[model samples]
Target: AQTVTQSQPEMSVQEAETVTLSCTYDTSENNYYLFWYKQPPSRQMILVIRQEAYKQQNATENRFSVNFQKAAKSFSLKISDSQLGDTAMYFCAFMKTFMESSGDKLTFGTGTRLAVRP
Candidate 1:
């Protein structure tokens, strides 16, 4: 079974600062996908960023970037120029590519609560 571990239960950052959240996973499959999701107070799960196992290059989206280490099975998220709006519960998810006929379901971590202080 693939499992994601987020050592940090809670974190806080000042507005306009940068914060990096750590995530590690264990998966036997050679090809899989990793993702970082942010859930705000509204309780909507939003995709922060994603990385394909086959791709050595990390993925970045605006202020969010990932440090993907395939060999170590680690995927970390870096939030730059953070704001009060960035405060939320961040979850790291793992997905294995099943047959096209199969359903798509995401396996998520326990999540890290991020509090951005003004």
Candidate 2:
């Protein structure tokens, strides 16, 4: 069984500041993938960052980055110079690399509501 957990239910940061969202997961699978998704007011889930279990290096994109700890089963997202547009609901997701069937899907956490204050 696999489960994702986001400890922070809500977080606020001033614009241009940096904020780190905490996430942890429990999984028995050796090969898997972790992802951070952002869902804005439009209610569309967008992929922010992704980390492969086998990769030692953390994943980063622009101002968005992730601190992936494979051994500790933790994957946290760090947003630098946060902008107002970054305000959204962040979700942590997990997916097994080996899919037994087409029905395989990702397991998501409760989510963290991030408000980028002006």
Candidate 3:
């Protein structure tokens, strides 16, 4: 099993600014995928960005981007042009490329609470 860690528990950012959340993981698996998920006040989960272990390119979705360092097992989420609506709990998750008997399951970090202030 892999374990993800988010060092910062809480952070506040001004609207229209930028913020970065740090994440690191310990894993022995070779083929895997890393992801960042956002959960707002309503509890709806959203996929921020995804990075593949085999791919060297970082993944970005809109204002959300990830800085993935495979060798260091580090994956950080960077929000550009942050908005008030971006306030939420951000989780760093990991998944293996292949499915296991129990099905593909995601191992998640404790999470970082992001509050965007107007």
Give TM-scores for every candidate, taking all chains together and pairing residue i with residue i.
0.96, 0.95, 0.94
Model 3: per-residue Cα lDDT over 12-115, one tens digit each? 99999999999999999998999899999899999888898999989888998989899999999999999988999999999988665656789999999999
- Candidate lDDT scores, in order, read 0.93, 0.94, 0.92
Model 3: lDDT equals 0.92
Clashing pairs in 3: none
In order of listing, the candidates' clash counts read 0, 0, 0
Question: Which predicted model would earn the best lDDT?
Answer: 2
Structure candidate 2, residue pairs in collision = none
RMSD of 3: 1.4
**16-101 in candidate 2: lDDT tens per residue?**
99999999999889889999999999999999999999999999899999999898999999999999999999999999895556
Residue 83 accuracy (lDDT) in model 1: 91
- How far out, in Å, is residue 98 in model 2? 4.0
Considering summed lDDT, which 10 consecutive residues are worst modelled in model 2? 96-105
Root-mean-square deviation (CA) per prediction: 1.0, 1.3, 1.4
Best-first order by lDDT: 2, 1, 3
